[model samples]
Target: MVRRHWINLNGMWDYLITDSRILPWQFYKSEYFPFDGQILVPFSPEAPLSQVKRQLLPDETLWYSRTIQLPENCLNTESQRLLLHFGAVDQICSVYINRKFVTYHKGGYLPFTTDITDFITEDLTVSILISVHDFSDTSYHARGKQQLKRGGMFYTAQSGIWQTVWMEIVPNKYIRDVRVTPDWDNSLVRMRIRVSSASSAENASPAHISPTAADQTDSQGTVLAFSPDRQNSSNVICKVYPPVFLEADGLNDTLCQDEITTAAIRPGKGATLSIPENMQKSWTPKEPWLYPYSLEYGKDRILGYFALRKCDVQIADDNYPRFFLNNQPYFQSGVLDQGYWPDGLYTAPSDEALIYDIRAMKDLGFNMLRKHGKIETDRWYFHCDRMGMLVWQDMPNGGSSYHHWFVTYLATLLNWMRIPVKDLHARLLSRTDEFGRQEYIDDIRDMVRTLYNHPSIVTWVPFNEGWGQFSTKKVTDFIHRLDPSRLVDSASGWFDQGCGDINSLHYYFLGLPVPESDRVLALSEFGGYSLRLPEHSACKNIYGYKKFTTSEALTDSFSRLMENTIVPSVKKGYSATVFTQLSDIEEETNGLITYDRKKIKMNPLIVQKWNTKLKKSLHS
Candidate 1:
């Protein structure tokens, strides 16, 4: 659980890249003596924003060291525990506090935490050392779109702390996790709050939430205490702070107490909250309303928000499956957003930089963005939630090598021929390692858990173009069970399992795609009209499906594509359509915007007019 009180450990830190493999205590010793230099936190060493702008190879290990002084109030008592949270650390990592080993973790994209209460001393100022080893494409880890050799489509590999690092103080027994699921059909939100016990002994007795746990004011709330007299265990008590509603004004600074109601939180259990009739607001792209809530356990309070919305695929009046938002037909006109930057490869330069990308797309009249093959910082999703943008999240691809003949040309040919190829062979899909397949499952589950709260995320693409396609039915069921609320495109572009919600397709040179299945039809990817502005380009050798020298030519082609292809497809039961991209990356000059984001390659007026036409046609 995230708390209101925490330190943002995202500034400069002492960094060192070493060829030697040393133990955690060796950093404090004479070996690997002085730190090489300083690097910015949250940005990978390979990124320009980081001072240490160099990649750490597979053989070398990256080290980060910093001295942090705790505030006077953090874990002031013996009954409190200080938790250190890492938003993400690439590959494998180990942490040490004051030269003592704290914890170790694996995987690159998921967040992890360890309790540092026992590691702290009387001085309060503690030394932190993190050792990171990322094998990049060499190992079976989930490195989203990161390649050792940077080029078109693939990007530069990065390691070490590539995301936010922070620490929060909480009571020994506090709220560990809270999951809120919005039920639009019932007009109620189901909330499940999990509490952790402070008991240290394994044989200690268990406890349960009292029957009188809900609707009890602070005065009437029963304060549960941990097992006292245990060696290191102190009497940790908790107070149930009633949940309150706040206006969805971005940060939820305004309170909406007129329609406010409270529910009882059972210890080690879940609770349900019914939306007040006066405050029931369905979240839509037209009117996105977020219900901000703060659930507190003892002194630790964490802010959370939820939206009442749902996306489903159902048969329309035309006898074809159509996408519905809040039980009403909604067309998903989206752009492909490869969340990359000129300064930061995977990471955005700043929080505002992330906001700008989403805002830019929304301003252009597109309602959704397919985050291609990479997950983003939590704040990015928050902006989408507050600013009214939908997202179709893609799981990062990993495996040996994709079958060019089968996945590319042959698959495309078969798609044109309307022949469904059962792409289960490991070699065909590039999935050779059994361990890697398991890791992919684990990582995808973690990704779902991490981003489940955002209402903007309505769809999950497990395998795109059969890059690492394996066990399609199993994986698709797994993702569906993870968040039954969201739609899952099991096999997005090719190798359709015919299991998921949509029959997704990708067409590049072909004139827009038409519905070929009884299920919801989606042109998942199309229209790669490229305009390379040399001044704004990142690389010299530009690549795209179609190239245009002039902005006028590009805009005209895009306008024609939308008018003749996309708009007509909508009338032919095309429920959703995602254009090739929002911005260019590396050598792929196919974005509507330039790679550096300095200029929009197409005319805004033309693009907006095209989008307006598409929306009007779909709505009509």
Candidate 2:
């Protein structure tokens, strides 16, 4: 969710890393605490861009302090409220304003906000402090692909804030959340808008989408009520605009567009907006169409956008269960996107850097990206949505150290032997922590809630390569309950439970095979051909499934792999193929591009030609 009016709180900030035994609040209240050198905000301490190239150990606590003077317009008034937002903070964090605790949040990937109107002083000067503690891989927290001892596929572990921190002003009574569900089969869109008031209880019951007009409640369960005598007795009005086919440069004004249809509905209730056949524009990777809309409740208004498109698996004319986009058989040529940077680690250097990655992949003819083992920021998803790139999002994996001999070596052997291994061995998979398992479930809910509005995401991948895998069928069922709209890859790579919509397989050391299954077939991971350029590499050590010495050799191998194996498999019921990776990370040289993003290891024309062949093979 993005706001038009907000202040970014990113820059130099006073920071200190201390022993976990030191009480930050006690020292803050006493007005005396040792301060360390300044570290760049938002970038973790371990990141090179943060200027302080140091890692926050598990036993250490990272503290960030800064002073902010609020604008007069943002100061709390009778009708306005001030809210502070953190895009994300690793593991756990606590916030203090004016030496008093305001809020605490857990989970590292999703955004959290707190109302700080009451904490504002008369002079509009606020002293803010944040303390963060990240257990990294030592605990059962949801740390994705981050390792204390980094090497091979795993990268350096980073802690503290790794995303934007900002503030915004909103009405006392505001739209808390909005969910847009596109009913493509019915040619309509369903919207669920939740509104909250200052007078309501702090903790209210969760709002469920119902056809009938019911009381409106915020995401946190606060009921939204208005007096009978209040003006505009109609609770809420929703206006949906016609779909716009905009050029890449025209996306900046999407939120300020005009509407074509209006519907009045009670808050928290579902309202369907039918799209006329003449105005219906299906969103695709070639032409991503977006329909903007605004929700107005009294003086509060918020804008959002959605696309009228559907993703499903259906038996095509070839009598194979193939991936379908907008009811037509489609072959997804995708790349495994790690979303990591050599400079920023978990974060990108700039917004343009994020866009560059998506655009670069698109230019290389990759229509989809399997965001592997990590959840990205909203801006990354926003770029994917607007750029028309389909996404398969993976839930970050977390648990104690896995038994590599069993989960990795043995699983690989089993996969090669075409023998299925049950995910019931929780201890072997390092999922024995009952509390950690529940936290993973909660993380799923939060991730879906935050990213549900994006139109580019087509699949949800719960488990990858048996990392922290447990209760595969049950987790797939839970994801279905959470969001039945998108397809789910219950278990990717190995340990298939014979569930989920896609029969996902990964091949690196073995030959690519056309799998026989009732579900859609996908080579979720394959073709890890690597060419490491020492000048652009993150480390001198090389790790890849297949090694190559030059760009020409890698490109030649890629062309043969696509033409001989992947393109031919499309006709044999392979609905999707995701290459090993888009870019190199740390010591892993199995990427099409180098770690610094300074070079594309393969010839673009050769890659594009093969990709074109993949697209045409679906119909041929």
Candidate 3:
């Protein structure tokens, strides 16, 4: 149930940076703090728009305050339940409404919901205060590329409220969350939904079962899904609504939820439910097809959709592994998307912005996005689910001391020289970085739980470039145990403990080479070939693999990289390749698009022609 009328708790908020040794003597709802002035919501303090453009020291904690009037309906609801939702809050967040502490959430990225119904009053105002502290890469936490002092590869630091804030109203009994997993092998989709009843006891059973008019999608279709355990029981029968056609108008028209497609339901098992064979649709980047099912469950409702697709790795003729999607081997063309924005930094401005990145890349013939370092907002994964873009999600690296000078030079350099570089390898061999190790484990558990539902996410990468390197086998096993649906890439760049799905490689300031015989080879990072558009560039001190002065040279070099290295090698054995980046990030100029997104460094046709050539080569 998407709420439409609730006020956005985003925008301007009162904030205070304090070294407080004591709690506020008397704090209340909607009350202002000692006004340290206003800040833009959803943008970190370190960002340009966050107003307080200063980084919080490790010892210091940030305080924030804001007041909002409770809506008339919130206080007067028949069920008398009001729910507040925080799309995401960094590190940790303690929430309050009307001067009472209600809940707190830990984890840098992932949504949390709270119940504020019992605390609501007609004349009451909603009050909130939050605190945030981050050490970024300094201390071992999922810091991604954030550092106190930013330079090559690492960008600005971001903190506090970088996601949406909103509220929702629901009846005494309503759906809380739904886990939808689609299985093409059985032509079935699984739904495990939770419902909450406002008046019921804390752990009481839900009010009722069986969905009603409230069960729906934006397409005006009724909701219905199969209950595998009760399949033979015709107790619940459904008729599909209208069909949605989005491609006719292309980018100009918004794609509306056209209809509710219903399926049979059984109680517990997945085998009982069956999807008609003809209705099955395969999802691919070129033709990303998503079928929405407006699921109904006894009056309460939520939107659910799934794509019919299969991804697996199989031994090929050349003895190297190949990636097959929907039974066909397709070479994966990917870009390293940090998922950062100029305005929001770690977060995108809106859901549309996230979808646009995938669509834009798809239009240029790429199929995958290697999410670099950071785990993204769930909405980002939702966009990927409905849009048909494959993802290689990374677990943000955080741990004891990174060997910047030695690791990259000795390990990565010597690997190119075919020399094994090992001092002791993994965190087990190093005793000093205990804090980094524990933090890594904590973040990994949070990552798997948060991103488990998205189908587009096909792989999980735990570490990159030997940053805070630790136990590879243990971490890899943990991720697989959490969700075996997708592939796992244990180590992205260097310090290979000889575990994981793809034998990944990072090739920058170098050339792509044919991989060895055995594992599925992925050129995880390469072709940083760059061209600077002076008018649109961030600055002159930027870096890239090879600097090109002209579009012709850049495009020619890119084409050569594909024709000679990528395309030929893909045909031989390689399954996927990750280009250096999607956009020019701060100091990194080797991006397909300029920093501001105002200019395309290479002509679209040049890229398209080569992509098409590669596609044809793979099929041939």
Candidate 4:
């Protein structure tokens, strides 16, 4: 998600929240009105990181206003486009540039953009106004685990902008997008480039440019006609330069960059390019190699990088379905990461804060993390890619209230017997609403498309413990069609349709199961042992599968669990294991590290020793 010519519009903004339910037509006139107060950008109002720490109620509508000045020599005149990008905005969002409506988006977790070149004059500064409406738990939006009434397992709801806001100046005829996939078996790196249209916005109407005071009352909202002026791009030239790598011995290597490949491609249509086998370097957790690339087309040039690797499931020497990376059988010793912060609910405080979690987990000698139930910012996956950590990404769950008697209590009992419920039973799975079900499908596709390039993501979990789960087998096939590059966990914990790359399960109070299925056996969730330190916990409401008193005792229990259950299970066909979690969250005081990120609950050295031994035992 990184680009060369961009501005970070994340700092301060005028904010207001009212239960008045202001209509979009009133926005143009309200721009001149004063806001109630100022709040920090990219942090939800409910989060502590945002200066305005207040709950954004479902009945309230939030508005944000900010002014920005474009720097000199920033926009590419030939490309004739100024792209305004928002990292994310909760639920429904409407964006305006200088009183004129620019664009609108519905999803909460994905990014959106608008081309404002026609509306923006040669003068630098421009006004930006954003409106957001979030109905947490009141509606069937794909909010992860946020609830109106926060408590155990569910957290306080956050709304509005909770991620970075930025603007990128791209050439009118720039490379719109690129998809890179590794063909390790053929020793090649395949790339699909999407080129932007060559048309300019010069003839756009100016009547709506600066709307009159009389025009402000229009209920239909200002209509600014702007769409991608796509051009015939089949004849554009694309140049691919060989990758350059940093040396380990304090010496830089330039030999790799001497080779280059050039080709002609269509700008509007999809075109393919390949890096020769000899020039590619394979990527892995032990040696995370990134091949730096530079792509040039017409008046546009972009610099990016990609890793060469492959993920699959195959029978190993021991006759167990093993997870394979780069055509080699490897064990994914992982921990479940919920990815929530005490100060910043969904958003990390800073980029370094995101890196800290990934680096700390890798330092624990674990290779993978099952990102439980929620999707993280793109930078989180970027860090995992460069820091040599594998990831199992989960699509955030959303649906109606669960039928506790059937979906919760009875489901848990049936899980013990390794039985799966009829996933199509909409009521039991919390997917009774048809609109909510379709929205889930759409969100998963968008999630996959957005995170496809990250090498760290090896598996996609569509259903976890049957929360909002429906149409398991069909959904599994749909995901495979989206991207066959990675494995799919059809059902992570329960309601297993027996369709997917792995036979995934969850166990808390007893020993792990050794399933004799045709698929890879994965203990997706286990070992939620809790040890509450008064100084480190958020509250006295201690919750976990098992409770302990001291760090010493916790470490002792963790070591014994690995030695007696996990290690032997690997030999008995358990290909992957995800310990309950990486860090404590709210009342769930069962993590290797405390929630505030101040203390390591377990002895790092002892945990590291056991983890290393466990990894080595996978091969034995």
Candidate 5:
């Protein structure tokens, strides 16, 4: 969701690194802490684009300082409140305004906001300060694929702010959040809009609002006004537009059409709007239709969008369980997207860079992407929604050091021998710490809540390759309760606990085989065929399941794998297959594209041709 009145605070900011023992309050007490350099906002210090070119250690603290002058019209203090928003900060952070501590946040993957209405001076100038600390992979803090040593699968560690920072001015009583759920089978859309109370309580939780009995009607006999169940409820208005087609410039001509429906309600409950059959459009990879809507509450307004689609698993005519999208069997030809960049590390260098990665895969005939072991910026999912791409979101893994002998080497050997392994050994899997396990649960809740509204996400992957895997049934049940709309891959790679909607498998060096199970079958990870271009490679030490000397050899081998193994298995029962990766990351050279994104390592036409063949095999 987005608002019209907001300022993007993304530019250069003064930065300083200090020992973790140094207290943030010391800066308020006239203590001298010199900000030695400037780093780009929304880019971690470890990223090349940040201009710091330094890694923040576990025992160090990264501090940021900036100042902004508010707009002249924003001085209506009695009616308006200023809210500061941070997309994400690594590990943990403390925020301050005008040298006074405001709030503290943990968990780096989700967003946090602070109401800084009282911190602005009379001149409308505000000084902001933020301090961050990241443990990286040194401890159990959900650090996904980030290692201090930084080699092989793990890459460099980054700290401080790694996402956008912004601010917005809103009325005292305003809408805080909006959640949209589409019911394609019923042709209805349900919404829950949370609105703030008139009280000036700082950071108080918003009250939910639902529609009450209709109090008034328009000349067309439509319910245009509704009364609130509670006396303090805010007057809310909703306008839902027809589905629009996205284009190169923006939304196409269909968006200019008159709104299909309008409803007025109050805070504290939910509302459902029915879409007429003629106006209803099912969202799919070939036709990514979206309905734009606006919510007006008191003096606040926000614009958002949603899609009508459904994802499930059902038995097809062949008497085999398969993945279904909108009541039809759909083969998910996907790629493993790590969401890394040569310049920005975790963050993409630009919005266009993120779009390029998604668009490139779609052009190559891939309909889905497994976001491996990391959460991305909201913009990435937004593009996926608008571009008609399916997503499997993985929760970032964190725990003490994993036992390679148990989780990797022995597990792989046992898997090849057709032996099933359970995730009961908490110590070996690095999930023994009670605090760490609770923190992992908290991280899961935050991740789902933050990304629940995205239509592109079809699966929730809790564990990957046995990293910090524990209580598979319990965690899967928790996710199901949180969101029953999507499928769950409780354990992606090694430890299949006989739960979840799919029996997911990973094949690197081993030959591909379709596992016989009552649930859907998915090759979650495979095809690590490497072709390194020296000029575009990030590191000389190459790592992949299969090494190729040239593009022709790699493309030919991939085609053979698809035509012989993948396509045939799809016809039998295989529902989905994810190629090892979208691009090279650090020392891992098993990607269709190079790390710099400057060159393609495989033949694009051959890749697209095989992908089309693989998808068509499900029905053939």
Candidate 6:
């Protein structure tokens, strides 16, 4: 039996609005800002659910205050590490507990936790204060598809706590962080653990997710046997006490990793298990098998999992390049999943909603999904890994304004002209503001570290369509060095920097792009065929390459476009195709699913059949 409990800290909470500082006791004792509004947790106020439904202006501060109660047994342990987690707080955030300033975190799309066990006492009436400032298109911060003025493709701004907020108590000595690196050539998952401080008396229990299913034609492999709590890792946790750093300088990455000699008593400094040939069942859309495990460091224990799969750029017999999985040619059929919801802006409405998208896409024969621009919560990646889906995760782009003509128009024309853009892109994006350049580097690293473990992620796209593009060659190589495990799409669209794993392309307002002879060509983005169902559309203002009123016509046009353009391009070396989107966002109506998630646009079986043939043709 599994232990599970999550008190939904969602729903309505008494909201008190104030600009200046007033004693908490003073406000509650009398009537204040009578203009009340209901704001949904895990969803920013800019979203529909947040009754205020307004943007977080660049120059203005949006303050939010809410009180929460701890789970029944959470505060019972006096010696435990009581941690509070925030999925995300855009731009910046300052946290408070029971009127006491506890910690502050500064990344828009990363998870952060603080130990409030000591300050927290009695019946858990905790006051959380978060302040956010988002400069969607005004400043150089990572703002994916969030437009303050809102038009075309960009929608709305998501600020302050758009993901779950909960409390968990860990034993003094516990597993702080787990990094699993899978070595396919060696047939093992190299495990690394970050433990709490040495003085912490808590125990550490380590474990791994073991797959039960055996590959009939190949030999089955096992992970290294985990050992009990021992000591710590060589890495150190930078922030020892309250008020964590506003922005962690990459300066702290390795140097701050505390030196811990005592960890698990396992014999393997690294472990290797044998994977029998042919008996191995490589992860795929049809059958997704996952192995979940747990680990302990001191008294702290962490749960995690992984999948068996491999991807790389290999030259095919016909002399063009392609992505190979397990040494076999596999066409990456994907959908452009813009991580958004009618209720939750950057956040998914629920975990089930995230899983629904992944499973639904898999059922439709899509083996891959390009996590477009926006970064999704960990739960989303976990689902993709467990379900055996391929992923091309994009690094959210943020920099000075795009060169409108070069990025939107001229670059698209360059795609038609068959011109390379490494030199051109470098020159264009180099002129961006200093803050923009710094933030891009900061967010990309955070993005990679956050999703490093999930087996489903196979590609890292640094920039998209020339937005915030810079040092194309160097950035591509840098990511390759940071994580050599996956492919790197240096530039994903019209900005064709001659770097990265494959020659990524995006075609809209036109037919399928022609594959080049030198590299593996991928229709990374295209087919933004739209269907406007007034009942389910996110907003009345619509946008797409083309729009259809009926599903039959949409499906027919999609199938015909693929049969003539995309299918033929694959044979000619175009390795993958990620359709416009997964769901109809505010203005984008080109998703196979609707914004309301009420219906599926195309027949799953039909789409599956087409995808099956597409894969087979590539290998054939």
The best candidate in terms of lDDT: 5
Candidate 3: Cα lDDT at 65: 78
TM-score of each: 0.90, 0.94, 0.85, 0.89, 0.94, 0.83
The list of candidate 5 runs beyond 4 A from truth reads 24-33, 198-233, 247-255
Per-residue lDDT of candidate 1, residues 1-620 (tens digit): 44666788999999888886575455476556578889999899998998778988988889899888876655575778888899888879999898888899988877898988888778677778899998987776777778888777677888888889998878776776666678898776766556667333311212234434333222223332222222132221222222223222344353444326554444443344567676778888877787767665565566677889889998777777889999988888899998888888788987778888887888788999999877887878888887789999999888875568888888887777677888568887888899999989998999998899888999999998888889998999999888888999888887998888888999885444464686888989988888888899988987888889999999888888887778888888888889889899888899978877889888888878878887777667
Cα lDDT for residue 377, candidate 4:
82
> Which runs of model 3 end up more than 4 angstroms from their true locations?
1-7, 21-23, 26-32, 75-80, 121-124, 197-272, 296-299, 317-319, 350-352, 419-436, 509-517
Off by over 4 Å in 6: 1-8, 16-35, 68-78, 121-125, 198-281, 423-431, 510-518, 603-606
In candidate 6, what are the lDDT values of residues 54-112, reduced to their tens digit?
Answer: 66677666666677767566655556767777777786777777667788776687888
Candidate 3 lDDT by residue in tens digits, 274-390: 456666666665556665544343544444445666777887555568887876777788889987776668877666777777777887888889998677877777667666689
Candidate 6, residue 549: Cα displacement in angstroms equals: 3.5
What local lDDT score does residue 362 receive in model 6, on the 0 to 100 scale?
Answer: 81
Which 10 consecutive residues of model 3 have the lowest summed lDDT?
265-274
Clashing pairs in 2: 204-221, 205-221
What lDDT score is found at residue 606 in candidate 5?
A: 94
| Candidate 3 C-alpha error for residue 266, in Å | 8.4
Question: Model 3 shows how many backbone clashes?
Answer: 27
lDDT measured at residue 436 in model 6 versus the true structure, 0 to 100: 68
Model 1 RMSD in angstroms = 5.4
* Native-to-model Cα distance after best TM-score fit, residue 282 in candidate 3, in Å: 1.8
The whole-model C-alpha lDDT of candidate 2 against the native structure comes to 0.84
Q: How accurate is candidate 1 locally (lDDT)?
A: 0.78
